[model samples]
Target chain A: MDVAIIKYNAGNIRSVDHALKRLGVSAEITDDPDRIKAAERVIFPGVGEAVSTMAYLRERELDKLIAGLTQPVLGICLGQQLMCQWSEEGDTSCIGIFDQPVKQFPAHELKVPHMGWNSLDRLSGELFPESLLGSYVYFVHSYYVPECEDSAAVCNYIVPFSAAMQKGNFYATQFHPEKSGGPGQEILSNFLKL
Target chain B: MLAKRIIPCLDIRNGMTVKGINFENVVDVGDPVELGAKYAQEGADELVYLDITATHEGRKLFADLVGRIAEHLNIPFTVGGGINHVSDAGILLSAGADKVSINSSAVRDPDLLDRIAGGFGNQFVVVAIDAQFKDEKWTVFVNGGRIPTDKELFSWAHEAQERGAGEILFTSMNHDGTKDGYACEALKTLSEKLSIPVIASGGAGKEDHFVEVFQEGKADAALAASIFHYNEIPIPELKSYLKQNHINIR
Candidate 1:
């Protein structure tokens, strides 16, 4: 299967590509719309500031291109946040694909960025196979998508927030499956099979 | 309910799992991938791999080891040591690390923390603080506890939080490997002071130590090396004990 990872000016795309390679699947990393659209599956993986990242995607017109893809498009970390309606990081507007707003963690005694391995409270979705239900996945995020119509999985830190979402062909996760171990790889592998 | 965490720390030298006290008397434990898998099955909440010799020839080996562990393990894992830049963080995360722990690098350039947190999101970035009791204050140490800084533990922790650090893995160098217990006072103070979760490392001798760290120190998690490596404490039983003591663990 041809797996295309959307490459913008972000830090972690190579790793995601490497992960796919380890899974014995060849993946192409690109920002080219035609290449992404042509692929059997697409992954938008990134690690950077939301606003600046969106700026880069917008400048390259990959934003519109990503929104238009018909194949299954998976967004990771910042990519997932950017797929939401808006982000409070820099008061930025996002792709509005998930119809949800990304908001910052409440400034309380709890940490702003809820990092480390946290378990998922499965809501309802076939996005995660039976092997992944109630399993712990790695997560590192400060802003989170509030529980909305599309939430497929939820995790609680200081409060509950959407951990994974699926809206038709556009599926996104706040957690980095590329970083998460077995459960993460399973999720990615499932996405690939889909 | 938030599930508690159990993390096993593996010290690696030349890509082989090793253990020692005060960073000396290194002894090979086992293959990192095997050990990691063992921990996962044993109900360990997470696993940590620290490259003791990450300076030169061992760096590539560490990455390779991470790749191997990532392939087999189903639980979360963390990698630390010799991570100096944002790119380095990217390398480890890509290699299958659930989170990247930074100590010396974060101390040298505070902005490095912000840049990493901004790029990777704060959740992937862990600021590990190695502190020692000195002059009636807990002082931050760098370079694997070889260099001491004037930064106070509390202040530096606050700065790390503000800079977007997702969690604070605090290690009391003085209490490390002492089997006495965690630095409860230090942990309690920091845990009460910061909103971010505080992981207490060093000085866990027995299962009771884990309970004490949670009940008294109020640590979000407890990390141990020798006890777990030497089979002194099995994680499943330890967690069972904690649960019996009315401490939350998973």
Candidate 2:
């Protein structure tokens, strides 16, 4: 299957690329909209500031192109947040693909940036396999998408938030599947098969 | 509710897993990939690899080992030691590290933290602080606990956060490998002070120690090396105990 990983000014793209190579699938990492639209599957992965990242996507007009794609597009970490309607990080407007808004973790006594590995809970949606219920995945995020109509799984840190979401052809996860071990690979494999 | 985390730390020297007390009296553990996979299967929430070797040759080996482990296991991994440049961060993250931790390098150039956070996102940048108690004050240490910085712990931690560090991995050099328990007092102070998650490392010997760090210290995660390497406390058993103690674990 042809998997296109949208590449803007971000990190973790190479790791995701290597992961797909390990799965015996050749994937392309590009910022070009036409190449992304041509792929059977799309992987939107980012590790950077939300506003600047969104700006980079907008600069190339990949923002609208992404929203318009009919293929199954998967957004990871910051990519997932940008797929939402808006984000508070940079007071930025997003793709509005999902109805939820990405908000920063409450700067209370609890930690603002929830790093490390945590398990998925209260999973829903057909994209996830039965074996994936209650499975642990690696997550590193400061802002999260609150539980909304598209939530596939939820994770809590100070407060609960959507860890994974699936709305129409777009499937996004706040967790890094490429970095997450076994269960993570399973999720990636599922996405590939889809 | 938020699920609690269990992390296994592997100390690598010359491409081999090593464990020691007080960061000395080192003893070889085993292969990193084997141990890492074991922890993953045993229900470890995450794995941290610290390369203790200081030579250029050792770094190449560490990178190779990280790649081997990443290919073998499906879990989140953090890599640290001898990381001073954005290229180093890029190398490790590309090799499958979920996060690249900076210590002495970040202290030398705070802008390095900003550069990394800008390049890799703050979420992937972890600032590891090795603090020692001296003159009734917590002092930050560099060069693998060899050099002490005059800067106070609280201020350094705040600077790290302001520079966009995602989390702070605090290791009390005074309590490391002592097996007495975590430096709860220090951890609690930092945990309460910082807005980012604090991972309490060093001196975890028993399962209850994990509970103590979370309950009393308010640490987001607890990291240990010897206990896990020697099989003194299995990851699954530790998780079970944490669960029984009403702590979240998966």
Candidate 3:
């Protein structure tokens, strides 16, 4: 199976590729639109600023290429945030795959980034199996998309938010499945089988 | 609910895992990547690798080891030691480390935190502080806790948070390697004062110590070296013990 991991200005893309390798899938990390479009599975993984990454995507027209992908596409961490309509980070506009807005976690008594392991609540969609309903996944982000109609899973910290969201062939996760340990590997395997 | 993280810290010297006795005596254990992979399978929430190598070649070897560890381990890990510049952090994170921790260098030039955090998001930077209690105060230490500075514990931690630190890893020189417990009172104060997460290190002996650090100390994460490296307290047993004690563990 041909799997292409879309490359951009974000960091830690190698970790995702390494995760797939552990599952016996060697994916090509590329920024070329043709390879991304021709692959059976495409993964958009990132860890960086929203505005600068969005600018890099637009500079190479990868934004439109990613939004129009008809095949099964999985976005991880910042990739998931960029899939939303807009983001509060630097007041940037993102690819409108999911009709949701991303906002920064309000400063309160709780920590801002919401880092570490958290259970995935209300699991739905193909990316998350029924067995993974209450499974723990790794998360490290200051901005989050609130739980909405398209939410595949919800995780509560400061408030209930979408741990994973899906619409059409586009699937996204706010957590890093590549770094969530065994359950994370299961999630990446599910995406491969999709 | 966010689960309390149990981190197994590995000290890397010349690409080999070693257990530091109060940052002085070093005992070679085994390969770091293999030990890390085993810890991950044993339910360790995360891993922290501190590079203690001094030579240039040793540093390069550590970076190579980091890449190998990333290839094998599935869980998130942080790398620290001798990180003086933002480019040093970039090298580690680009090599597949989830986070880069800054210690004495951050204290030397406080703005290093801001530059690294600016270059690679706030979540990428972790400020590690080592301090020892004396004269009714906890004074910060550098150069592997051999040199003491004028920076106080609480004030420096707050300043690090304000300067874009995502988390703070505090190691008590007094409690480290004692096998008694963590600095719970100080940890509680640090946790309450900062909005970012606090990782407690230095003193972890038994399962009860883990419980105390999380519940009483209010730390977001707990890190231990000798107990885990020497197999005195297995990761699985400790986690189950914490769970039985009514602590939220991962």
Candidate 4:
């Protein structure tokens, strides 16, 4: 399958490309809108601040292009946050692909980023199979989307939040599937199959 | 639940895994990618590669090795050793290192932390502090625990956090290489003082030592080298032991 990973001013895009290569798929990392629209699959992966990232996306007109994608589009980490309606990080508005808002994890006894391996609960949608239920996936983020009607999975840190979400052709995960080990590999394979 | 992480640290010299990896049934033991893949298969949560090479060519070799490791392993990994500037960290991160750890360089120039965290987000930076207990006070040491700095342990760690460090990798020089146990008292104090995750390094002797580090130390993660590299304490057995001990483990 011809897969294209939308590249921008984001981090870890190389890691995501390596992950796809590990799964026997050579995905093109491109910023060209035509190639992104022509690919069979599109992956929006990033690791950066949300506000500045949104601004960059808008300046390049990639934000609208991403929201209009009708294929099996997957967003990872910061990519997922930018798909939401708005983000608390710098109080910036997002692409509005998912009817959710991103907010920072409340300051409490727990750590801010919620780093390391954390298990997912309430596995739903096509991105996660039954085998992924209660399986630990790697996570490294301070901001998260609250559990809602579109939540595909939930994870508890200081509070229960959306670990994965799916709506129409768009699917997203706050955790890094490329770095989540075996269970994470399975997730990427599932997305490829979709 | 967020599981406690088990990280196996590998020392890289001239772009090869060093300190004599003694794992049996392994080909090319000196190869970082091969050894790191094996650890990941054994249920290691993450890996740390400390590049001890000093030459410019050796740093380039280490970056190539980082890309090779990223292509082979699925879990996250951090690279450290001679990162003195933001561009140095940038090279490793672009080479597919999930995070770049700064040690002595960060001590010499604390702004290195801010520059890195600002350029690549705080989550991409790990501030590693090596401290030794002396004169009834814990003092920070730099240059691989060779030189002692005037900075205290708690205050320096707090400063790193304020400068936008995502995590703190604390290596108690006194407890390091002792094989008795981790500095639980110091680790608990660090965990309580900082809101970011604390990764305890240095002392890891046995399976029970891992338990003590996680349970009593309240560390977010535990890192060790010899015990894991030599197969003295296998990761699967240690993880199951932690599970039986009612500790949250992956």
CA lDDT scores, all candidates in order = 0.83, 0.85, 0.93, 0.91
Decide which is better by lDDT, 2 or 4: 4
Q: Which residue pairs collide, candidate 3?
A: none
* Candidate closer to the true structure by TM-score (higher is better), 1 or 2: 2
DockQ of each model vs. true complex: 0.32, 0.54, 0.91, 0.91
Per-residue lDDT for B62-159 in model 3, tens only? 99999999999999999999999989999998899999999999999999998999898889889999999999999999999999998999999999
Q: Candidate 3: give its CA RMSD in angstroms.
A: 1.0
lDDT of 1 by residue, A40-117 (tens): 999998777888888999999988888888999899988889999899989999988888899999877665567567
Per-chain TM-score, chain A, candidate 4: 0.98
Considering summed lDDT, which 10 consecutive residues are worst modelled in model 4 chain B?
Answer: B20-29
3 or 4: which has the higher lDDT? 3
Candidate 3 residue runs with Cα over 4 Å from true position: B23-25
DockQ of structure 4: 0.91
TM-score of 1: 0.87
Off by over 4 Å in 2: A18-24, A32-34, A118-122, A129-133, A156-160, B21-28
Q: Point out where model 1 deviates above 4 Å.
A: A14-24, A128-133, A178-186, B63-76, B83-99, B105-121, B146-148, B243-247
User: CAPRI verdict on model 1?
Assistant: acceptable
Please identify which of the two predictions, 1 or 2, would achieve the higher DockQ against the true structure.
2
- Backbone clashes for every candidate come to 7, 3, 0, 0
